[model samples]
Target: MTETKELSRLKLLAKRYARANRIAQHQALDLVAGELGFPNWNKLISVSKKGWLADSVQMASIEAFVTRALPAAIFRDGDPEAMARRFAHLEQAERGMIGDHTYRLQEILHEVIIAGEGWSIRIPENPGAIPIVETFTNQERECPALEPEFLQKALELARDRAVQVRAEISADWPRRSTKPDQSGMVRHPLCRGESDVWFCLHCDGKITSAQIAQNLWHCPACGASPLDIFDTAFWSDDKGESFLPVKTDGSTDRDELDFRIVDSRPKLDLTEEKIILLIRSALLDDATNISEKLGALQAEISVDDENGVWIIIEEDLWPEGKDPVQALAVAKLLGLEVERLSSWSTIPFAWPRLGEIASSTCDYTQMMLDAYAQYGGSPTK
Candidate 1:
């Protein structure tokens, strides 16, 4: 088809779409006004219609108005001529012309309004208004020449100074983990290896050396603390090659905590309490508040310290009786958190006869045998 014919057809389509849009917009305005119990629906409809076509309307504001009001107007049954006139006014107001560009713009606007459901025209808040394109002109100026190496060194020095300034500013922030000295070396209790040190992972509170041991690593500033690390078990080969358990109060013979039930039936008896206790103990000398909260089945609690308050949660506290879905629901109700185990079966066994062999073994496999016996099954073949 010739360009003139094509353009005319496109203009016709644009007019049709625009007319439909205005009717829907007016209908929606009436409905909303009625729902809001407005006394005069015609006044609201008039305001909305006029507002969209006002020359003073910001690009962002107009886009938003069209997005919401146009699609609904297009879908409603109405007088096409009146709708066309309203849209023509809008198009003229928006683009200041009624040419091919205006028609294409209308079509684009219609498609976006109908398909995008008002989201496409939403202005992002962070960057504020979109930037306008601008041309940059470079003006030539004479400058004194410097040695290439000297220029390179000067650039490097400037970069280093900028980095130092940023680092200093960041260090002053409450949650900073490291502070830089004049030499640009970051210094913190974790790096210093103070025997008594308390540091909060979530905030900027740290005490070094004996203080850490005394405070149990609880951040006095942020009230953030570390979880206790416990040596639950030690595994070794038959040749007496064994890994040393982490020393807690110089005790080496403490029995390993059991994570499974005696009868091998999954139960809540081996609860997550022990893990929470361990974390608390490791991070704080006196975790009385945390202990009390745990006792009450509260999974999460906020504590205050010198730096700030910290929100801590027992990340593994789902009741044993609930299935995954139910557990999730309970967690939401209690505002608790859940952590899934990496593996479904916590018990590690060797190969194809893993469970079968575990059921029969004694000595090294005493726990499994005990569980089997509890279930009224013999541990031995």
Candidate 2:
């Protein structure tokens, strides 16, 4: 049959739909034909040979039918278009109300995020993974997510969005990455590697072509991206002999939405580096003059095994017998003893007393430069 602009557009749409839904091209074409009021694609072509042109109304109707989410059950049935219309009649939405509460839906990185005023729910891309519900405020009694009806409604909305996200991801990948051939061989979208048995570098899992296709070229064991999947175990000495077969038992096609509560509260972990940073900051607070501030900035602080801190200050910058009272107080508050020591090293300038006389670093820098010029030499060569 002669192809018109509308027919070409319909073919392109069918190709896209087939890629996303993981079906054969012929099946997609038949689906398109079914939506156009034909029983099958061959019948449509046969009728078109007798001089028939689709009008704008027919074209718009077919386009609308192909674009929306169609049920997977339609592909398995004898009449795809009838089943498609049935599912479209009961369409789901991105935004809805479960009761008095309202929610909005979004998909990020193939995961669904449903959010409201002070609470949100995240449905993971993996269907086997549990959904996570989080509340922004500490008042759990007032959170709508705590209500059973609201939570279920929100979860279903998020999960529906997640399924769409997965479809988009599958559509973006190469067709072979999602559908294996009769020989159980598929190609990696990133590396373009073709093999019946694939290997995952991230988890060392041996995956079959069917398994790789089912997981959308991602490692089911570790959830690694297609970039990490290789056709051969090039890094292994035994050529994938030691690689274990990845178990996908947890993966099922059920629609059940199980959720888990996660606490995202921040916790402080005190380490040696943190203790040293605190001591250094305290030393800065103890500084009373420009020279002392410079000394504090350059001070070497370390933590000891017995909950003690050793602070080494430059003797040229810090005055002798001037104890760091603020630093000592901070250390005492942290239940740490302070041991102060002095190091005599080559100072930044020739005259150590210049910084002490000046109120700020800018003034001290000018004075030092002037002193150096008067002596017919710069601070450094």
Tell me, by TM-score, which candidate is best: 2
Per-residue error for 156 in candidate 2, Å, reads 2.2
Reference-based lDDT, each prediction: 0.29, 0.77
Please report how far candidate 2 places residue 215 from its true position, in Å. Answer: 1.9
* 1-381 per-residue lDDT for model 1 (tens digits): 233432233234333323322222244444334333444346643454554222323323333333322222233443446445444444343222222112111123111110011111211111111211111222242111122332232222222222222223322332212322233232232343322223333432334422222222233333343342111111223221232322222111111221111122234442345434433333233222322223123333232233221223332222233234433444444445545321122223222122333333343256545666676567457
Candidate 2 has a TM-score of 0.73
Candidate 2 lDDT by residue in tens digits, 211-277: 7776667787887777888999999999999999998742434445478866444557779998888
- By summed lDDT, the worst window of 10 consecutive residues in model 1 runs over 110-119
- What lDDT does candidate 2 reach at residue 18? 82
TM-scores, all models, native as reference: 0.12, 0.73
What C-alpha lDDT, on a 0 to 100 scale, does residue 215 get in candidate 2?
A: 65
